[model samples]
Target: MRQGIVRRVAEMALRIEPNRTAVLDWILHTPLPSLGMQTTFELACNGEGERVIALLNDLLLQPGDTVPRLPQSAPPALH
Candidate 1:
């Protein structure tokens, strides 16, 4: 179930970012505005992994633009 969630999020993000590595990086590195500027990792850390999946589902229902992306102001993903 955990892998399923990660894969689902990756697939959804692929629509906006084609590169798998970059998408995963964004997932772990980017802070979502809808979740109080918290990265998905942070959300999971707070024991809200399921909630993040639910939020992603809700966001998926809306237009593509509603989906979150890595902020330009954020530093590049570390090596």
Candidate 2:
């Protein structure tokens, strides 16, 4: 059950990453503890969780605004 929830969440994260509002809504509405990964999910969903969502939203932007580049380079090369 826990694994299933984590898998779903991970899949949702991948889909939501490109959409800021969706990500925000998801994190807000989803039951963190119910996902069966309470410790990890709660740690991520604490007070600063919203801020993290916002930050991710900002990072998804394409130019126009200036934000420091993520330390990592291009996403890992796909096979």
Candidate 3:
């Protein structure tokens, strides 16, 4: 089963890259040097989903990088 964090990372990547197929391909096949040459997909499946998310977040925060603002909404009403 895919983790919520993994899904969230893909959503964020789409906002940044705007190419779903390329982003998915990178997540599944690109070996990240920062991750010991492991693909993000493998990390996500190997119980390192949060790490993959963190790596993506770090990439967005890099100098001159355009990090998309996450959509904000008011908290749901309490019953």
Candidate 4:
């Protein structure tokens, strides 16, 4: 489940950012405004991994929007 979450987040990042290194860096270091300024890496550690995935999915829903939706159910499979 952890790997699935990571892959889903990375896939979403690549769809928008398209740079693997930058996406990884952002995931590990950058605090997300939507996640209440918590970095993605941090959220994942505290049982909030689904929130990160939900944010990515919400981002895809609104290409230019930055507001994050409330976390929902487990994300769909990558394939």
Candidate 5:
């Protein structure tokens, strides 16, 4: 069950580092302070799979201005 959650996290982290070994290593070793200083795998073993997923989802989120922009002042309409 722990491996399952860890693998799921690795799958998500793959977008950051395509290699399975490196990504797996990261998930197994990287300490996430936001997760109470637990590594992804450790947090998963503690039965917090959803939280780990959320962390990865946040990681996968692209940085950008996601807010919809208002249209500029319109030109005069034709008669």
Candidate 6:
């Protein structure tokens, strides 16, 4: 399910931003807790906390702009 969500979000990012490295970097790296999300990229980072922190160096992008998409497929598969 998570993988599906990620893929769908990637597709949307491709469509809307069309290969914007900063945006992708933000998506893959940003710590979402600042946006009041239940889960944070920090927690997701597990042992790689420093790397995740470094990835989130830029927080100028708003949370709304980085909302992830649901996969078009009915069932989400794990990557």
Winning model by lDDT? 4
Best candidate, TM-score-wise?
A: 3
- TM-score for each model: 0.56, 0.28, 0.70, 0.69, 0.68, 0.34
Give the number of colliding residue pairs in candidate 2.
0
Per-residue lDDT of model 2, residues 1-79, tens digit only: 2334433443445553545555445444443332343332453644334433444445556466554332122345789
Lowest lDDT 10-mer window, candidate 5?
Answer: 66-75
What's the lDDT for all of these models?
0.67, 0.42, 0.70, 0.71, 0.67, 0.41
Mind giving the per-residue lDDT tens digits that candidate 4 earns over 3-70?
Answer: 56667777777876877998888778777766787877778777687998777776679855575333
lDDT of 2 at 60: 53
> Which pairs of residues collide in model 6?
none
lDDT of 6 by residue, 1-79 (tens): 2224444444444544466674466456543444433222333334333332332333323366674331121334679
lDDT (tens digit, per residue) of candidate 1 on 1-79 = 3546666666766765688888778778887766788877677666666766776566557665565543333556899
Candidate 3, residues 1-79, lDDT tens digits: the string is 3658668878877766787887888788777666777777788888877776776676677786566532222455899
Q: Which residue segments of model 3 deviate by more than 4 Å?
A: 63-79
Query: Per-residue error at 41 for model 3, in Å?
Result: 0.7
lDDT of candidate 6 vs native? Answer: 0.41
Structure candidate 1, residue pairs in collision: none
Task: Give the TM-score comparing model 3 with the true structure, all chains together.
Answer: 0.70
Native-vs-model 5 lDDT? 0.67
Superior candidate under TM-score, 2 versus 6: 6
Q: How far is candidate 1 from the true structure (C-alpha RMSD, Å)?
A: 5.7
Worst 10 residues of 6 by lDDT: 67-76
Give candidate 1 regions above 4 Å deviation: 1-8, 63-79
